[model samples]
Target: MAILVTGGAGYIGSHIVRAFRLAGLDPVVVDDLSSGHREFVPDDVPLIELNIVRTKKLTEALRDHSIEAVVHLAGFKYAGVSVQRPLHTYQQNVQGTVSLLRAMAEHDIDKIVFSSSAAVYGTPDVDLVTERTATHPESPYGESKLVGEWVIAAQGRATGLRHTSLRYFNVVGSATDELYDSSPHNLFPLVIRALTEGHRPKIFGDDYPTPDGTCVRDYVHVADLADAHVVATQKLLAGQELEPVYNLGSGDGVSVRQIMTAVARATGIDFEPVVAPRRPGDPARIVASGQLAARDLSWTMRHTLDEMVESAWNARHQS
Candidate 1:
């Protein structure tokens, strides 16, 4: 039986596709190609070009592929843009999830690893966020992810579906030069774009309570995050019980200023970042503890900050 990967043509999704392949699993892709690149998916893999909300098409693809499990990553991913386009966000994230679940139920495809976001915690109150932390999402994107988890959990209870939701922190770096993040709203890509184009990278807020006067966040390498998904899917397929949720985090916080410094060192560029006013609802600091994932899924932060920046820089240039 093949594994289905939603949004397998996108940045993070593409990495998960590679990870699954490295583990000797067959993966089929379903993506709208709205924000994902067609070439990111390997030519050997079957690609069904369609949105997840197209229930009829998705159901047909599931049956045709003999899909036994799914790694769900397709959705509206821009948290900042989600605020301005709440309706569009819900249509893509919430409705899209509902449709995928419907298709899975029809085909008896019972295993799924949800690609969730730290946004669900919305500037969490604690220093180290855990699965028990209360959710208070501040953006439509975050709310949609949290809702997706709820829907998946409810389906699991009703249908005996084996599933787990992985709440990701800042996902950066690249596993290969062939695939790199192209999101205009993400930090790593934005900074890389600016430096390559001979522009100063901008730091939105520099007056936060962080030690360096910038927003502190938990950043994890994209490749590491993808490996966790593979492990989760394997356990679920093996009839092993897993937690309903896990935080794929670094357990340590890295300030934006430190990122800028790391970029300068990596790229051999020396320019002060342009500090702008803080965005509304911006949290001063939000890091997470990946202890649960580490214990269950072998989650680990295998890359240093410098390595993350350097790898991202090299991939952007080489691709």
Candidate 2:
């Protein structure tokens, strides 16, 4: 039996695939490579360059590899972009998730680990967001993710399929020396792209309620996030009590300027930032208390902001 990962060629999915390989498990990859790079997957891991929406091809891949469980990471994620193309986002994220679940059911492969997001919890009245926080997503992207989680929950409850939804904030940094960091949407690489290339990074929305008046977000390293996936899988494989939702984050929130400062310190480029208006539907603060993950999965973030930025910088420019 093998583990099949959708979007395995993408940033987070690739790292998770790396973790699975490191843990002595082979993962079959199915990615259309729309945004994911083909080079992300290793030579040994078989890659099926197919979209999840294509039910016929997906089912064949599952049966061919004897797939036991799936890590669903195939979806678009950009708040502003989603707002512009809400219809496209819904069809891709929501419809695609539903199709994957149905395909898994048909193939008799039930176990699944979903890659959820903190965006599900919009700017709540509560500063620190927990899993119990009302999922009042302001953007279509968040709503699509929430819907995806619901699909997993409803399917798991209805069927014998066991599922764990890992809802966390931004995915940062790379594991190992492969220099696995590159996404236009993520801030770290964008900042590094600007600084190393002698351009000023733009800080969107400078006057938020945060201390630095930018946006504050829960940043978790990619390796730590991958570790949680492995631990979560082990828990389910060991027949441990199932947790519907467990967050993965550094408990501490990092602001925009704070990140820039770290970048400046690490790269020795104390450059002025270009400030811009905030994107619509952006939350002022988002911090996570990953105690539940710590208790259950023995998961903890091992990398600091400096480590994250420094490593990301090295990966983007150095490598």
Name the top lDDT candidate. 1
CA lDDT, candidate 1, residue 208? 86
Model 2 C-alpha lDDT versus the unseen true structure: 0.85
Q: What TM-score does structure 1 among the candidates reach?
A: 0.98
Tens-digit per-residue lDDT, 1-319, candidate 1: 5899999999999999999999999999999999999999999999999999999988887777889899999999999899899999999999999999999999888999999999999877798999999999989999999999999999999999899999998999999999999999889999999988999999998888889899999999999999999999999999999999999988999999999999999999999999999988888998999999999999999999999999999999999
> Tens digits of per-residue lDDT for model 2 on 15-77?
989989888877889999998889888998999998888887777767778787888999887
How close to the true structure is residue 99 of candidate 1, measured as C-alpha lDDT? 100
At residue 237, give the lDDT of candidate 2: 67
Q: Which ranges of candidate 2 are over 4 A from the true structure?
A: 177-179
Give the alpha-carbon lDDT of every model: 0.94, 0.85
**Where does candidate 2 have its weakest 10-residue lDDT segment?**
176-185
Output candidate 1 Cα RMSD: 0.9
